[model samples]
Target: MTATIEQPTKVRRPRATLQLLRITLVLHALLIVAQPIAAGYFLAGNVDAMTDIHATIGGSVWIVAFLQTIVAACYTIAGHGRLWPTITSAALVIAEFVQLTFGYAQNFAVHVPLGTAIVTAVVWMTVWSFRSTARLSRREAKR
Candidate 1:
């Protein structure tokens, strides 16, 4: 008997919904990172405009977080993917809203810590989205 070697299967590209999820994840992460930078500029008195820019970035973060939730839902249902992304995205939306409220209220005690949490969550999701575990097929998800 002769032994035969098997070739590994080629990796396939992610479906459209997953691609959208990844894109939104990256975009959301980028926007989240910009928040602290803008705030730092304002705090350092580098420019008066930094305050408005920081506020604008916060609003943008909320919008993108909302959009990410929608995309994650589509990815989960339409693409037959894991549910965690959807849940995480939704939580981010709620957190972002609270962050904005506290910021406007000048509640730095809450706003500052919440901002740190938001950044950590966004970074975690962004990193996970690109990992091999995240790209596993629906079969693995069911298992």
Candidate 2:
């Protein structure tokens, strides 16, 4: 006579998702805060020039930066299961490109470089993440 073997329930699935979200959290938050952070970096190089630019562009840059970072956070956390992250991430990408266009026209040299880099990185990451999310949603829907 042979005994039957049974499998145990798994716990790593959701944890993996959370882990992925945490990466987005760390990277997004750090880059989002780069407005003030980069100002400090630039200050060491040219305090007077950076100070003037920070005073003028700081508010708008920080607002968009933080908001988009939040959106990225949302994307990583619940994006694979819902539709909002997809919409918000799409909007995040579009809004950022628009900002980039306007900012470049205004003079990329004078304004903060970190803002441009952050926005660009967010746009690309958001787009890629959204594609993954769309695939997952489709798979889920079919099931």
- Per-prediction backbone clash count: 0, 0
Q: Mind giving the per-residue lDDT tens digits that candidate 1 earns over 116-141?
A: 99999999999988888777655575
On residues 1-143, what C-alpha lDDT tens digit does candidate 2 reach at each position?
Answer: 99988887432222344345445534554544555555676657877645566444543544554555565445445554444544555565555455556554666563446465555665465455535433354336456
**What TM-score would every model get versus the actual structure?**
0.85, 0.38
Which residue pairs in candidate 1 collide?
none
Instruction: Give the whole-model CA lDDT for all candidates, comma-separated.
Output: 0.87, 0.50
Task: State the TM-score for model 2.
Answer: 0.38
Candidate 2 residue pairs in backbone clash: none
Q: What is candidate 1's CA lDDT for residue 25?
A: 90
Q: Which candidate is the best by TM-score?
A: 1
Query: Backbone clash tally for model 1?
Result: 0
